[model samples]
Target: MADGILRRQIQLAAANLSEAIDGADGFQNTHQSQHCESAKFSIEQVVFILEKIHIMWESVLPRSIYRRSMFHVLGPVFSRITKDMLLIDDMAAEETLQLQGLIHLALENLSSLFLSLVENDDDEKFLDHHTWVQLDESIPSLKKFRKLAELLDMSLKSITAAWESGELANCGFTSSEMRNFIKAIFADSPLRKECLGWIVATPA
Candidate 1:
């Protein structure tokens, strides 16, 4: 079925993105650009897959279901992912750190939404059982997104740690300076609130 194939593609893309993020962790400043390019490639793949999945969901689900609040919530999140992918190339290291945080938060929200759908049966009464089953088939990919979120968080923390220990001197800022700089930038940006909202908001 087309739905099954799309789900598999999403899973594969998430797996590839996770692997690329992991690979990025092993590089220093000298090789960081290569890893960044690799990670960017994977991210673009994920964005493409997600865009396809969004289109598929819209096509396959009933209009009523597609218009549901829960389904609508994902639209902005997917848009953010695509936008972030486009901007990744232009971001400085500190900007990329903030972007990673936003990505992790967005993925966490998506994962929570999927988990809620998987665990709750109340939707079965409104949506037909067949449609519910179709949605359920994508749960594995949702779980993969959660795992990817955790990995992204870990990668960001590792990079911060390296900076703290002066291990990233070649990248220019000392640990304390980078920390202050991030705080100042994020403090002024509305994105900080948006990312926090994603992290703390309940699934619809």
Candidate 2:
């Protein structure tokens, strides 16, 4: 019963993300206001899924059995999603569209991982090297995503600082929204810290 509910929730979340990606693609090259609105709606869908995944992590699954491998595979994905969602509101339309595609990719990978876990009933296999290999293979892409997100975050901060100091006035660049967004990104995302904790606890 729990598995059924969990699978249902995952499917719903994946479907929403897929729809968001398709919608974003359709709006690509449209007016900025329209594109931004679509992107914001898509981000809300992703955030909804993130919240569901967090609940599944804490409540649906047995922590003692699944915590290590489950978090191992999903932690970085969670971190990337949180970081990307935080930045999406301020990103250009094309960038948000690109991020939607990336989020879809992560969701696909996560669904496959969860399917594998369900099929292999033996808990022993969960922590085996094969599982580790599967989890490890995903790390590189996630690491790349995190690196890109960090760079983007830094760039946004620099741009915001420059604009605040009136250095970019001649360029007509202004960011009244970015400073508040950056603060909210860092201050509100406890999931980012939790995901990092899982990474740190992972064995080398």
Highest TM-score model number: 2
Task: State the lDDT of candidate 1 residue by residue for 146-187, as single tens digits.
Answer: 332333344434534444454444323233433343343344
lDDT by residue for model 2 (1-204), tens: 266775665566556556654555433432366765675565555555655565566565675434443444355445445444544444454554455454554444455344344335664544455554454354444433433333333444454444445543322222433343344334445653443343334322
Score residue 30 of candidate 1 by CA lDDT: 16
Best by lDDT: 2
Model 1 misplaced stretches (Cα beyond 4 Å): 1-31, 63-204
TM-score for each candidate, following the candidate numbering: 0.29, 0.36
TM-score of 1: 0.29
Query: For each candidate, how many residue pairs have backbone atoms clashing (under 3 Å)?
Result: 0, 0
